[model samples]
Target: MQIAERMQGVSGSAIRELFKLLGDPAIISFGGGNPSKACFPKEVIREITDELLRDKADILLQYGATEGYMPLRRAYLDYILPGNGLHGELDNVLALTGSMQGLDLLCKAVINPGDVVLVEEPSFLGALQTFHVAQAKLVTVPIHTDGIHADELEEVVKKYHPVMFYCIPTFQNPSGYVTGAATRKRIAELAAEYNMLVIEDDPYASLRFTGEKVPTIKSFDTSDNVIVLTSFSKTISPGLRVALCFGNKDLIRKMTIAKQGSDTHSPNLNQAIVAEFINRGYMDKHIEFISGVYAKSANCMIEAMDKYFPEWVRYERPVGGLFIWCTLPEGWEADKLFRRAVERKVAFVPGEPFHTTPGAGKNTFRLNFSAEPEERIVEGIKRLGDLIREMKAEM
Candidate 1:
């Protein structure tokens, strides 16, 4: 059977492809958004599993409602709300397979083929893939430390009047920049003023190592214009595959319809586990431990870049999150440097695929620190820096 034209634009993820190439035992990869296996809280989860089975075996294994287990959804809402400074009744929360599923469902509800979708330039590649699969025409807006530039966004709003604006506002993927409160408020205001839907994908908010906690765009929203998606993959265990989505009830009702048709519901067993984890208050301690490990690793990476990388390979020391965004010196080709780095047993994601505009981020690369130990991060940067120097020599 011939495939549809939409499938042509949808291909294997560049991040996943890079991860595949780094599967060799010899390489240290900073390419994927994998959680550190060390922080899984295996013992606690094991006890929960045993206790749950000993007590509630049938419910643990049986089918659940399309909206999810009511208690689990309620617990999840409570768990995530205190951090964001937003509180709503039980109806506000929807459990998801992962936050990625939530994004897909939102696209299914709001995006028609060829509808314009405004995305941060060099945005999360996965979000880009989701919009691409929905067949939305994506336009790029530049991202700064503050967040998506409001002026550029206003220009796009004036021209295309996009249907939705998608972003990973906090500890944003690939870029490692946090959207400041001012920008967050501005985005909310603009979305309200222009009558555009905003999708905030914040999977890494709990990984902060420094600075005050930033508020979500949804916090400033009174007009039901923003949808927020978050996940336990970064904060808790990823193998469980559970996340949360909160938004305007009308939009959420449509998303729930799309979701029911998509997967029926996220796994009930995993939801039960996550609910227990959160209600028991294990998550807070787990995040603190995870933050310490990641903070040390991020610090090590920044320090290595300062000591070993060529002076022109500039990067921001992200206050939190798993990744750092690095820009090569002018005229250096990051894709070529990636090849050399892989040859030397070090791996990273080339920045080209992260952009909505082709070739716009050719001199940039993203390095992840959460998956590897500090020693490995140091060694990897040394190898990558050597490759950078060689690329400069060739130029």
Candidate 2:
């Protein structure tokens, strides 16, 4: 069978491939970025789902608009957007099956083959794949512990003049770094000045456990070039596959058209459930509850790392998000460490695959805390720390 040429260079998701190793009950996985199962508001979801079936069954069971279920658009406007200092009518919003779909739709809507798309150096792997599949020429800006630097970002934008800049400003995937407010504002300014579309993928902003909440890039978007993709996966439920994008009406329309042939429409029932989840005043309490759960998990992971890992193994304790990004000493390959750790029933994602630049991040890895319990998190870190120590001694 002949596969499409676009897929020739693109490989399967590293995390998904790693999931095949998770069937072993002995393996305590720190690999996948999954929300803690305990964080789910099961009773609330069950009740909401049951009520939707009982009351809104006719609308939910029927086909939904490709644009989206109207209530979700309104709910997003009423509940989600205002918090981010954005306000818009229905035309500005489009429901997505997942925030990942927003990336795909955006690519389909605007990206042509070889169009320059700027991204954070270590970005979300899934978004990188989407850009690759679109045949976009991927360029990257470096990310520091604090996040992308504003001056550096401006330099790159001026140099590349990219069509789109994709970023995860708050608790960025793999890195778990928050781009500061000043940098975020500068990004929005640069977007307007350059006429570049900035895709702000913000799924983890609501997960903050420490520090002040920084304003979103979209909040500083004066020229309307910044597009914000918000996800309920981390906050509400990943299985629901409910996310929404808000931005320039023209861009939203293009993505809506693209979505038509993709899923026809996001599942009406799921949208309705999320809308009800918000409208009924459940989102805040739920987020607060889950944030505490994640906070405890983060603390546990950090404590374990501090106690178990050697001083040479460097890492930043994330303020929020599921991941802890770690860097082994120079010339130490994390891929080799991953193999040895897996043999001992521990797993994490190696970092090289997250970079577009050749031979980058070979000494790095990402550990997710939210998927496992406190004991499992501690145990997994111990196993990984032990493996790292053994590798370092051999060096």
Candidate 3:
């Protein structure tokens, strides 16, 4: 019954566990960052999948290279990277079952137990878990509404001299904050200066509804210390489990070896489908359509919150990404609010799991706006607001 010491303090994803509560048909969930079902290009995917089965089944049904299905690596180079102001050859890319796998593989490839790994104070919970399981000594850098300051980040790097830094620079999870372009460039610089490898987990950059498209940290990685992980989950289909990462060739090779030990290889059929999806010029149009759908849902939720919630509860109107981070009044705990919400057939993620520092984020929680219908979003927010008022009255 001995679990490895690496997993001693690690726990399952709080969001994944929340799916258990979603079995009730009446519960309007805002817990997981689930892209709208409407966002999936079902017809296009069906058409592509059919063609792949008929034409490429021999290759796809067989074991794929641990490096990835070559076409996907190539498609990413041609279609995905250019928009981010990046370019990479095949050796620089690796296909992932999901972007989360990229983090795990990176950890396996590089981290030694107790090595310092820096993260945004409030980061993606899944990534945090991966680091914990890898036994990386987790450290935090503060991020604000404007994202982290380059000078401040440099000070932290100077302090810890970490093995790597993990961040979600654009439309960051839980908080929906975006690190600006100038700071991203500086981050690339800090990585080189300290020989720190920066893991840029950028699953939501393509989801921007407003604001200028900022450059990724990898774009400025002159010393090749930054790696960028991009996913089709938010843009195409999460179920497909297709994602890719571009980085230093040496690092990618190490990760590929690590990936082999884990999944052997990512599913070839899924990689081929996504590769064709990109090559056929379907990616951009699909992003536009889905972005519009999510934008409407986000606006509806915000409008409902404004009309229903008290002024003391604070959050920003997100320009993109699936979440709205809310902070309740000081000394109020959101896990308590979550309990009351579920009783009313509503749900959201309490913010504690997303934070690395002790006792941080007790007053905070995250609401995902991408999963529910517009009307359902309104009703959920109204019910949530009502519960907050009811809980306060009892207090």
Candidate 4:
């Protein structure tokens, strides 16, 4: 059997591979960006599912529209986007299996082999894999604590003339960085000026725990060059696999068509569950509740890092997000630290795989605060810190 050329050099997600070690009972895993099961609104989802099945089983059990289950799209348009100061008609929306599928469908609709796709340095590994499978030439710009620089983005756009620019503008995945309103505005403008499509993957936006909410890039979009991917995975139950994208109608139409060849349509029952969740006005209360949960966890993790880790290891207090991004000093390998840490029964995702640029992010890693209990968070950080200090001493 022969594999296709598109998948030639693409590799599995390092984060996904780390799941294998997770089966060990002793390991304190900070590796996955998984929402705490405790945070899930179990009773609400069960109620919603029961009600939907009782009232709408025939329709939901049937195949759904390739576009989406209508209510979910309407709910996103009505309930979700409005808080971010975004609005879209039905034609502008497409429901995704997860936000990751939104990326794959976008690649299918827009990218030809070898077209350049610009991404933030250390962007979502899942997305990098999708682009690589689409055989796109990946280009990257650096992302700081504040976010990617506007001027640097413009420079990259001018140089590469990429087909698309993928970003996680709010509470970015690997780094927990948020691009400010000013840069977001510039990104929208650049997208229009360069005729480039912008893919804003924003699963973590609703996870914001502190500070004023920043405007989304799509909210700043005047030329319809920006498309926003919204995922309920973090905010609701990830197992539901419900997400959607809002963007240019034509592009959305293309993606919708591409989606037909993909899943026929997203699962109708799942869509109905999320749609009812939104329409019932549970979204806000739920987000606030989960935000409180994550906020306390994030605080606990930060305090632990400060108390346990050496000052030389760098990281920031995440305002709203699941993971804390950490930078080890130059010449240190996070991969090696990861092996030793795993032996010590602790786990974190090494940052190198999140990065698209060769040789970048070798000394960085991401720790998820939303998965484990506070005690485990503290213990894991302490173990990781000890390993790092021990490694440094050897150096």
Candidate 5:
């Protein structure tokens, strides 16, 4: 059997591969970016699901509009967008199965083979894989401790003239870096000036535990070139696979058409569930509650890393989001460390696959804090740190 040329070099996700190890209850995993099981509002979701099936089963079980379930589109525009300093009409919103589908849809709608797509260095691996399957010419701009530098972004945009720029502006995945408001505005402006499409994947924005809220790039967008992909996977439930993209009406319409052939519209029941969650005044309160849970977890992980790891191991203390990005000393291999750590029943994602640039991030790795209990988090760090020391002793 012949496979498509676009998928020729693409491999399975490294994170998904790590998931197979998670079946061992003995293993303390810091690998996948998963929200804590304790954080899910199971009761509320059950209640919402019951109510929807009781009253709205006809509409939900039937074929939904390719555009989306109408209530979700409105809920996003009226309830969610204004809080983020964005406003859009129904044509601007498209419900997605997950934010992952938003990337695939955008690539289908706008990206042709060989079209340039610029991404942040160490951006979401899922997005990278989608772009790869689309056979895009991938370019990258570096993200620092703070976030993507505006000057570097402009340099890349000017050089590559990319058709799209993908970013996780708030509480970025894997790295947990937040792009500043100024750079965000500059990004919006650059997108307009260059006629480029900016895909702002913001699943972790509301999960902030510390630091001031930054305005989204779409909030600064004037030319309708910036699109915001919002996910309920972190804030609500990943199982539901509910998310939406807000952007240019024309682009959205294209994606909607593309989506018609994709999932035939995101599951209507899931979309309704999210809409009901927002409309029932439970959204903010739930976020506030889970934010506290993740905050404590993040603090626990940080304190453990400080207490257990050697001084030479460097990592950023994330203000928000699930993962803590760590860089080992130069010449150290995180892949080797991962192998050793897993033998001790501890797991983390080796960082090299997260980078599009060849041979980058080999000395780095990412740890997820939101999935495990505090005890597990501390234990995982201790095991990883001990293995690092053992590896160093051999050198």
Candidate 6:
């Protein structure tokens, strides 16, 4: 069979491929955006499994709804709503194999070929790829410490008049920067004014490690333009692949049709398990515990970089999240740095692939501390630092 050009333009995730090289036992990977296994409620899942089998052995094995299991959908509503001061009945929630699938459905449902989609310059690579595959023109908005630059976004809105603004508002991937509440309100206002859709991909919103909690843009959304996608992957278990999207009723209906043709909804058993997880009130308490672990792990990485990395390196002090963005001094290439670090038994993701434009972010990299043990984080940083020093000496 001949291949499609769109599929040709799409490539495997570079970070996922980089992770495969880590099959070598000598390597210490700071690359993958994975939570520490210690943080997962493994025992709780085992208990859920046992109870599910004992109570409803045959039903757990049966096929389920296209929207998802009703009990689990109801449970997800109860899990996310109270904190945001928003309440929704069963009509508002749609479960997915993962939030990533929700994003795919949204893209297919909303974006037509050549439709403009605004994204963060250094956004989540997966989102970038999804938009690219759908044949949408990817326009970038520069990200700020507080949020995306409002002035630049205004210009984009005026210029391209994009169909959607795809954003990871809380603890953004690659940058780990949280968009402030004022900015979130502004984004919503701009979307309403421009008649654009807002796809808020907030997988990490509930994982705040420090500072005051900020309300989601959806909480302030009166225009019904915002669609918020979140998941249990980071805070709970990634393996089960359960996630949800809450948005305007019309959009949800369209996406439900899109999903029905796609996978016929997310896994029923996984949804059932997650429902039990949330029903038991374990998700709330588990998130707090995960936050603590991430906070300490983040501190370990920052402390290690401060103590060991050269003064020329620049980086953000992430308020909350798994990774830190680091830019090596000018004259140091990130891919070369990755190669050198791997030689020394350490690894990190080169930053270029995360950007919408090519060649930019060549001097930068992202290090994930959430998955590795504290000692491994420190050691990996130390090794990466030494390699950079050695490279600098040669220059």
| Each prediction's whole-model lDDT (CA) | 0.85, 0.92, 0.91, 0.91, 0.91, 0.85
Candidate 4: which stretches are off by over 4 Å? 13-15
Q: Is candidate 2 or candidate 6 better by lDDT?
A: 2
lDDT of 3 by residue, 1-395 (tens): 88889879677855567668579989999988889887878999899999999999999999879988999999899879998899979999999999999999999999999999999989898899899999999889988898888887988899999999999998899899999999998999998889999999989988888978998899889999999999988999889899999999999999998888899998999999999999999988888988888888889999999999998999999989999989999899998888878888999999988999999999999999999998899999999999999888988
Across residues 199-293, which tens digit of lDDT does each residue of candidate 1 receive? 98888998999989988899999788998887888888878889888888887788889988999988887888888988898888999999998
Clashes of 1: 0
Q: Which of candidates 1 and 4 is the stronger one according to lDDT? A: 4
Show the colliding residue pairs in model 5.
Answer: none
Q: After TM-score superposition, what is the CA distance of residue 376 in candidate 6 from its true location, in Å?
A: 1.2
The residue ranges of model 5 lying beyond 4 angstroms of the native Cα positions read 13-15
Q: Over the stretch 1-395, how does candidate 2's per-residue lDDT look in tens digits?
A: 99998787998966578778579988898888889888888898899899999999998999989989999999999989998788998999999999999999999999999999999989899999999999999999999999999988899899999999999999999899999999999999999899999999999999989878899999989999999999999998899999999999999999999998899999999999899999999998888888889999999999999999998888898898888999887898888888888889998899998999999999999999999899999988888888788787797
> Residue 269 of candidate 1: its Cα lDDT?
78
Taking the tens digit of each residue's C-alpha lDDT, what string does model 5 give over 72-160? Answer: 98999998999998887898899999999999999999999999999999988889999999999999999999999999999999999
Those runs of model 6 whose alpha carbons end farther than 4 Å from true positions after fitting are 13-15
Error of 2 at 25 (Å): 2.0
For candidate 6, write residues 199-268 as lDDT tens digits.
Answer: 9888888878778888888887888899888788998888999988888888888899998899886877
Model 1 compared with the native: what TM-score?
0.97
Q: Give the clash count for each candidate.
A: 0, 0, 0, 0, 0, 0
User: What are the runs in model 3 whose C-alpha is more than 4 Å off?
Assistant: 13-18
Q: What number of backbone clashes does candidate 5 have, counting pairs of residues 3 or more apart or in separate chains?
A: 0
User: Which pairs of residues collide in candidate 1?
Assistant: none
